[model samples]
Target: MEQLIIQLISGAVGGNAAGSAMKNLSLGTLGNTIAGLVGGAGGGQLIALLGSGAALAGGGGDIMGMVTQAAGGAGGGAILTAIVGMIKSKMSS
Candidate 1:
């Protein structure tokens, strides 16, 4: 639960940051956030499936595990946002 929350927040931040960094791939704030949330959830589940679930959600004091999860979520969010942006640009063009 805590890990999920952490991932979600980090994913949102990552999405916004990526959007700002890549102007051509930037989605509006709301779009980025929505994409980030979905990506975050997906990423968290992916990480769990990859066998990191126990380490991440096992102990309440597992800071490093939480950080790792956050990183995964962030990366997922950024990647998904980029993909969506590319598709949108292509469709518009």
Candidate 2:
């Protein structure tokens, strides 16, 4: 239960950061928050699959592992948002 909350929060932060960073693509506050949550959760799941012996070993995934994955996703989302912003700026100008 606690772990779930953590992942959800991480995702919200990342998405918000990314959304705000992007120029015209800004998802507004609500949009950003939702994006972050989804991205983080998705990232965490992806990480678990990759880390567990090609996604076959850990039949029972770890909570800590998922948390870390969510963090990575949040970070990635921020970076991606920045990149998108840059591209948009270049195109606009």
Candidate 3:
């Protein structure tokens, strides 16, 4: 229960960051918030699953832990968006 809430908040933060970092994504405020939530929670789940219990219960769902992971994921996502945006720009012309 606590874990879920933390994860949600983490995701929201990450998605919000991602939106801000991305100039071309234009998900809007509400969309960005939703995206952040999804990204944060998804990243947390993925990390836990890939870590194979190593990340589980070990600050895995904690506020700081989730925020850090979410930030990383959001940054990665922003980078990905930049790459995609560049590719699109180049291809469009």
Candidate 4:
């Protein structure tokens, strides 16, 4: 639950950053946020699964672990948002 919240917040930030960086792919604040939230949650979960399966699998009970999780979530969110934005842009054109 806590991790989910962290991912969602990070995802929102990531989405906004991506949007600001690429005007052509910007989906507006609300659209970017929503897409980011979903992407973040999914990405966080995926990372957690992979992380748990790896040798580095040490529960996210530590600061570094938490940071890694947030970074993964944010990165995933940004990528997803950019992909979606590009698709939308292409479709509209």
Candidate 5:
């Protein structure tokens, strides 16, 4: 549950950052945040499925594990936002 919350927050931040970094792929603040939330949840599940959790656990309670998880969430959020934004842009054209 804690991880989920972390992912959600990081995802929102990541989405906004990505939108600002690439206007061509910006989905507005709300859209970006919503997409990022979904992506973050999905990405967290994917990481669990991929067994990356074990690698992180090997560190035995270190900041790196938390950082890695946050990064994963952010990356997932940004990727999804960009993809959706691009698709929307293309469809509208």
Candidate 6:
């Protein structure tokens, strides 16, 4: 639970950062946040299933586990945000 919360927060931050960096791909704040949340959950689960985040899944309270989850969430959030932004831009074009 703690890991998940960490992931979500990290994801949101990542999404916003990406959005700000890529002006052409910037989703509004609300959209970025929503996408980040979804991506965070999915990414965390994927990492856990892949065994890289097994410690987090196992409910470990270690700092490393939290960091791993945060990394995964942030990457996922940025990737998803980019993809969505590209798609949106294309569709509008």
Candidate 4 has a TM-score of: 0.88
Give the TM-score comparing model 1 with the true structure, all chains together. Answer: 0.89
Best by TM-score: 6
lDDT of each residue in 1-93, candidate 2, tens digit only:
443455567767887777765647665677567666666656555654566322222433665555565576676455544554556567889
Query: lDDT per model, in order?
Result: 0.80, 0.59, 0.54, 0.80, 0.76, 0.83
Task: Give lDDT tens digits, candidate 5, residues 1-93.
Answer: 656776787778787788889899899999999888877767755775576754454545556656666777787788888888999999989
lDDT of 6 at 42: 74
**True-structure lDDT of candidate 1:** 0.80
- Judge candidate 4 against the unseen true structure and give its global Cα lDDT, from 0 to 1: 0.80
Cα lDDT for residue 88, candidate 5: 91
| Candidate ordering by TM-score (highest first) | 6, 1, 4, 5, 2, 3
- Better candidate number, 1 or 3, judged by TM-score: 1
In order of appearance, the predictions have TM-scores of 0.89, 0.58, 0.57, 0.88, 0.85, 0.94
Worst 10 residues of 4 by lDDT: 52-61
Candidate 3, 2: how far from true, in Å? 2.3
Q: For residues 1-93, what per-residue lDDT tens digits would candidate 4 score against the true structure?
A: 667777899888888888989999999999899888988887777888886322223443666667766886798789889999999999999
Preferred candidate (TM-score higher): 1 or 4:
1
- Model 2, poorest ten-residue lDDT window? 52-61
Judging by lDDT, tell me the better candidate of 2 and 4: 4
Query: Where does the lowest 10-residue lDDT sum fall in candidate 5?
Result: 53-62
Ranking by lDDT: 6, 4, 1, 5, 2, 3
Model 3 misplaced stretches (Cα beyond 4 Å): 52-55, 58-93
The residue-by-residue lDDT of candidate 1 on 1-93, one tens digit each, is 788887788788778777888889889999888788778777876886787765876656577788778887888788778888889989999
RMSD for each model, in Å, please?
1.4, 4.8, 4.5, 2.4, 2.4, 0.9
Superposed Cα RMSD, model 6: 0.9
Clashing residue pairs for model 4: none
User: What value does the lDDT take at residue 48 in candidate 5?
Assistant: 52
**Model 1 alpha-carbon miss at residue 71, Å:** 0.3
Model 6 segments more than 4 A misplaced: none
Better of 2 and 5 by TM-score: 5
